[model samples]
Target: MSPGDEHDFRGMDQGGRGDDPYSTLGGTRQTRTRLPDGDAGHPHARRPVRNSRSLITITGVVVLLIAAIAFANRGGGNDDTASPTTKNPGAAGSAPTAPTGTKPVQGKNGTIASGFAHDEQGAQSAAANYAVALGSAEMFIAESRQSIIQATHDPAVAQKLQDDLDTAYSPAFYKNVGLNDDGSTPTGLTFVSRTVPVGTKVVKMEKDAATVEVWCTGLVGLAGQGSTKPVTETWFTISQELRWVGDDWKISSSSQAEGPTPVNGDNRASTADEMAAAVDVYGGFTYAR
Candidate 1:
């Protein structure tokens, strides 16, 4: 099956406690103690009475202090305290998903992003963007496929990869997927092929090479009335071996596998026209670490 056919198996009671401490420590007993009525000359005669008003004031102060501390520990809405996933909505995984805040590469080879950094982050960014290009609708078209391969693969393998893809996305393949021989949709239909990276991870990194895996969910099929192959979603992970060449990362080789798929939600399925319109309206992203 094509990459797109992957199975979609895809508040503490501080105030009350403070009062308890005082009460449990014989506070009430102490308050109830009364000096002899006539003991004016006693050594403790000058001491002021500890009233309930005093206890209440002290408890209020303690509660306020506890609350202030809890708020401060929460970082007062600081981004540092935010979960990594929250910080970078596109990034997945448990840790190290925080945004580096590095600007996306300014360079582009045709429509593909390039000029990645020399670090692990850059490798991940390159792998993710390359996955997007490889799974794009453009890959079904000859000229665009060549452009994508040239922009994504290492020079040594670009030609071979292009040739292989040309064979794999043959006219028969296009027809099987409900597209024309040249990768165009039939009249009144929209062909959709898009890969969205859910997260990325660096399996291994070195000075000159890196292996990164991009977990992706994609939409692939024709959207229109009477379509045998209606637009459907698939989940897969693309593992890309990258090389830092000429100040950028290029894919040396890559492989894909079925996903860590999610259970289907209970939402109503949209109509063909609705799906087509949504695809047309929502543009893809240039993924980055």
Candidate 2:
């Protein structure tokens, strides 16, 4: 709802401190250290300090354990009011409740999927799917981009939106993303831009209009030998305002903001060739709530 530039979903940009003072004795100071059980009067009496630090560490651990227990008890269901579950990953709970086996969508619209249900759940699904389509690398090309914009956006605004998107994905932008001036991948490289939805939430809902926020993890960049822009993952949240149009939810407008990012995993980084192979072999999904 703010005037923060609607199409500001820029790609992730690739991009610490210090030590001591008052060393009068310089590096040769004769320091007296005390044992953990030493008397307090002794110049080396560090025993009490060690004990205090240990106590503080133990206290911190206990507090965190108790907080974890409380958060787990709260469960993962959508909280009526704002809570840590809405923003923080692994804040609490086990696996999410199982899906109800309901169908995700009724059919496809020109190459894009569509025909979502007409409820909050439907709005969430539409947002997630539209995010995938809009975030795909295919949307860089003129034909595919126009198709995607027409398929996902409201018809009343699709033409203007398509023109805006065309300008946004200019030749300069394509070059920046390691694509050719015409949005084609360079020789022997595969440009990857895919959005995978982690979850969706209904931020607002009404009879014929709704707003849904979809949290997504995306992979973007080029993959292959001698590629400077190797694919990297980024986390972002997309908020879509949807309208029930022609019996299905269509995006009236949308905006994206960075993060809600979690700490990186300990997995080993794969080789560029391996990443290229994986991207070639693996396929993306049509995300749904």
State TM-scores per candidate.
0.67, 0.67
Candidate 1 wrong stretches, greater than 4 Å: 1-94
In the predicted model 2, the residue pairs found to clash are 34-44
lDDT of 1 by residue, 14-117 (tens): 11222232221101212233434446564433333435543332222112211222222232222234333222323554446677777557588899999888
Candidate 2 per-residue C-alpha lDDT over 1-289 given as tens digits, one digit per residue, 9 for 90 to 100: 1111221221112100001110000111112344345365654422122232222221221122112212222232222564333332223433352575777788999767798988766777888898788777787688997888778877876776665555556676566556789988899988777778888877667777776777777776678889866566656566676788998998766544455667554355677899989988998887665
Q: Kindly provide the TM-score of model 2 when superposed on the true structure, using C-alpha atoms.
A: 0.67
What C-alpha RMSD separates each model from the true structure? Answer: 26.4, 17.2
Compute the lDDT for candidate 1: 0.60
